[model samples]
Structure formats: C-alpha cells, structure tokens
Target: MLIKYLGHAAFLIRNVEGIRIITDPYSPTQGIHYKPIDENADIVTVSHEHWDHNAVDLVGGNPVVIRKEGERSVRGITITGIPTFHDKEGGKERGENTVFVFDIDGLRLCHLGDLGHKLNKEQISLIGRVDICLIPVGGYFTIDVKEAKEVIESLNPKVVIPMHFKTSSLDFPIAGVEDFLKGTERVKRLGSSEYEIEKDKSPLEREVIVLKPAKSS
Candidate 1:
C-alpha cells in the first residue's frame, strides 16, 4: 500500500487493489494554507464536523464519506470508526472525533483524527491490533507530545506517522514535528511526501517515518 501525506491530518492511502482512501480532508478557509486538496479517492473519512477535517466536498471521485462510529466494508476495505473526542473533557470543549481504522491490503492502519485525550482500556480494546498509526502530536487542540508518546505505547503500531502538527503553512499554535521526534529512535526521514509499504515485504517494526507535505506552500 502507498501512503501519501497531503498536509495537516489529511492522507491519501492506496491499496494494492488500487482502491484509494483519503482521511480528514482539510479546508483552505481554516487558515491551514496547505495547497487545496484536489485528489480523488474511492472513500473519504471525516473525523468530525470541524472545518479543517471534514471538507468532503473538496475530494473528487464521488467518494463515500464515513464520519460516524461503526464498522463497514467499502470496496473491499473494512473500515471501523471508533467514537472519540476533540477535547479531553468528553467533547464538551471541542466536539466528537472519530478514530478510523482501515483494514487494507493485509495491513491495519489507524488514523487518530484530532484525538484529544489518551485512550482508555475500552477504547484500546476496540481498536485492536494496529500495523500503522497516523497520529496527531500538536497540543493545544489535540494531544501533546507527552500524551502522544503514551498513546503510541498503548497502540504499539509497527509503523508510526505523525501528523496535524505545526508547519510553515499552518498558522495554528501547535508544535512542530521536531518536538514529537525529540529523543526518538529509528526515525526515517524520507524527504518526500509519499511512502510505500509492502505486505510482509517491508520491515514491519517500530519505526517513525517522516515525510514532507505533498501540497506546495
């Protein structure tokens, strides 16, 4: 499968069967400043109703949008949306968030959409095994670096990809990816916006893969 970072919390994942899925399509009006998302996908997952993460209209291909918590199979991909919160206060501060788990091409990929708090035993049990994790490390609006580390330990995904952090184009008061990378080991800087993982072929271990945003500044 190929995973391409589309800036912010958005990602374009394509499985071996050529089925494409886009996660958390952001809006330009949110002051994110990432190049407008113009990619096409077979499925689009929205974490919440927030303007920055639920702009399903920006995506093409007349994709199927999944926003609520449930289990569904779309185009041979099994997607499970676990209800979460955008704030630690049980959605009182921000709103509801959904952590999407995609079973594609023999791999289980989890996208923590603007996750606010640490996962409890119940949430962890529901998520099950995770091969790849797309997490948000920025603080103010989501979990901070410290909490992110704790969450990573719980999920224990073989591959970790940090997103929704501070970037040159983002005006949010969030920390950069560097803050999350500090003191981390086995970090691979691909220097590109895309990374490919082969089933059983790629080294499936605890490694942090950093990729540049695909969208131009």
Candidate 2:
C-alpha cells in the first residue's frame, strides 16, 4: 500500500486493489487549507468530531465517514471501526473517537483518530494486532509525547507513524516533533511526505517513523 502523510492526521492510502482511502482531511491552520494530489477517494475515515480532524468538506470525491464502531467494505479493503474514548477516561471535551483498521491484502493498518488520552486495557484488546499504526502525538487535545510512548508500548505495532504534532500552523499551541522523540532512540526520520509499504517485506521489529508533512498549497 502507498501511504502519504498530508500533515496532521490526514493521509492518502492506496490499497492492494488500487483503491485510494483518505483519512481526516483538515485545514492546515484554522483558516487555511492544503491541496491534495488526489482529492477524491474510494473511502474516507474520520476518527472524531473535532473541527480539524473531521474536515470532510475539504476533501473532494465521494467519501463516506465512519461515525462509530462498525465494519464497511469499499472495493477490496475491509475497514473495521473500533470505538474508543477521546480522552483518558472518555471524559474529554470531544467525547469519543473511532480507531479504524484497514485490512488490505494481508496488511492490517490502524489509524488512531484524534485520540485524546491513552487507551485502556479493554480498548487495547479490541485493537488486536496492527502492522502499521497512524497515531496522533499532539498534547492539547490528544496524547502528548510521554503518554504516546505508553500507548505505543501497549499496542505493540510493527511500525508506528507519529502525526498531529506541531507544524507551520500553530492554530493549536502544542509541542513539536522533537517532543515526541525526546526519550525514544533510533527513530527513522524519512524526509519524504509520502511512503510506500508492501506486504512482501518483513515488518520492523520496533520502529518510530517521522515523516514530513505534505507541502500545503
């Protein structure tokens, strides 16, 4: 699959069947937005109701938003939604969020949407095994660097991609990417805004991938 990190939580994923799935298209800043190469997609997934993380209108093409825990099939991808609390104890300002699992070919890809707090034992169990995890590391309304470490440990994903941290847009005053990697070691910082992953190769035993945000328009 081809995964492109479009800043914040937005990403464009092209699955095994040549279907594109975009996740959480939001404005770059509070008032400004970015341009997408392929604005249209076969499917779109939103984690919660946050204004930035749920900008469905900015995206082009026919997209469907997964509002709750359920399963949906678009083209050949098997998308499953697991309900999760937005905050540590489900008492955060935004209420709840949806963690989506994209099963394309043999890869199990998980995207954690606007996750405000750490996942509980029960929530982790429901996540199952994930090959690639797209997680948010911003502090104001999501898990910060320290808490993100705990969450990643419990999830035990083969590959972890950090997102939603500080960028050019400081609409939300949060920490930068450095905050997320302060205590971690040997993290791979890819300079590209997009990455391509195939199922043939062996997954990373333990790795944190830092990618550049897609150049906004």
Candidate 3:
C-alpha cells in the first residue's frame, strides 16, 4: 500500500488494486495558499463537519463517503469508525469526531481525525491494534505534544505519522512538527511526500516517519 500526505490531516491511501481513499480533504478557504483537492478517489473518510476537513465536494468522482461511525467495507478494505470528540467536553466545545481504522492489504491503519482528548480504555480497545497511526499533534485545536505522546505510547503502532500541525501554508498558531519530534530518536525523515509500505516487511517495533507534505494541486 502507498500512503501520501496531502498536507494537514488529509492523506491519499492507495492499494495494489488501484483503490484510492482520501481522508479529510481540506478547503483552500482555510487560508492555506494551496490548490484544492480535485483528484478522484474510490472512498473519502471525513472525521467531522468542520470546513477544513469536510470538503467532500472538492473531491472529484462520485466517491462513497464515510463520515459517520460504523463499519464499512469497500473494495476489500474494511473500515471502522469509532465515535470521538473534537474537544474534552464531549463535543460541546467543538463537535463530534470519528476515529477511523482501516484494514487494507493486510495492514491496519488508524487515523485520528482532529482528536482532542485522550482515548479512554474503552475507545482504545475498540480501535484494537494499529500498524500505521495518523495522529494530530498540534495543540490549539487538537492534542498537544505531551498528550499526543501519551496517545502514541498507548496505541504503540509500528509506524507513527504526525499531522494537523503548523506549516508554512497553514495560518493556525499551533505547534510545529519540530515540537513533537524533540527528544524523539526513532524517526526517519523521508524528505518526500509519499511512502510505500509492504505489509510483510513492516517494522516489528514502533518508529516515526516524517514526510514532506504534497502540494494541494
């Protein structure tokens, strides 16, 4: 499977069967000076209704969109959405959030969409074991560095990828990825936007892979 970071919380996941899944397609109106996502995908998973994450119309093709919490299977990929919150007050502050877990091509990939509070034992148990974890480490609207660390430690996935942090294009006053990388050693800076992962050759232990964000166009 190939995972490409499409800036911010959005990602394009493709498999050998040509199945494409885009997560949290962002809007250019968010003040990010980049092109909008116009590619076609087989599926789009939206975590919340926020403008930055729920611009499903921007995606081309009549893709099947999974925005609510439930079990869905499409093109040999199994997805489970667990209910979460965008803030600590049980969705009173921000809104409802969905933590999506995907099982595709023998790999379990989890994406925490704008997750705010730490997951409890029940939520973690529902998520099950994770192989690739996509987490939001920026604190202003999501979990901070310390809280993100705690969450990563709890999930203990073989691969960790941080998202939703500040970048040159982003206008939010949130912590950058540097703050989360501090004191961390098991990290690989690919310097590129895309990564190909083989299920059979995946790591046995946890490691962080940092990739450059792909252009919005």
TM-scores for all candidates: the values are 0.98, 0.91, 0.97
lDDT of 3 by residue, 140-193 (tens): 899999999999989989999999988887888898999999998789999998
lDDT comparison, 2 vs 3, better candidate: 3
lDDT of each: 0.94, 0.79, 0.91
Question: Candidate 1: where is the Cα deviation over 4 Å?
Answer: none
TM-score of 2: 0.91
Residues 1-217, candidate 2: write the lDDT tens digits.
8888887788889876778888877755564345533477778888887767777777777776666788878676889898886777665566988999899768888999878778878788878888889988878778888888888888888788998887764456777888888878768888888777787773557778888878455
* lDDT score for residue 157 of model 1: 91
The candidate scoring highest on TM-score is 1
Error of 1 at 116 (Å): 0.2
Question: How many clashing residue pairs appear in each of the predictions shown?
Answer: 0, 0, 0
- Please provide, for model 1 over 158-217, each residue's C-alpha lDDT reduced to its tens digit, 9 standing for 90 to 100: 999999999998999999999999999999999999999976865656999998989848
The model with the greater TM-score, 1 or 2, is: 1
- By summed lDDT, the worst window of 10 consecutive residues in model 3 runs over 29-38
Weakest 10 consecutive residues, lDDT, candidate 1? 198-207
Residue pairs in clash, model 1: none
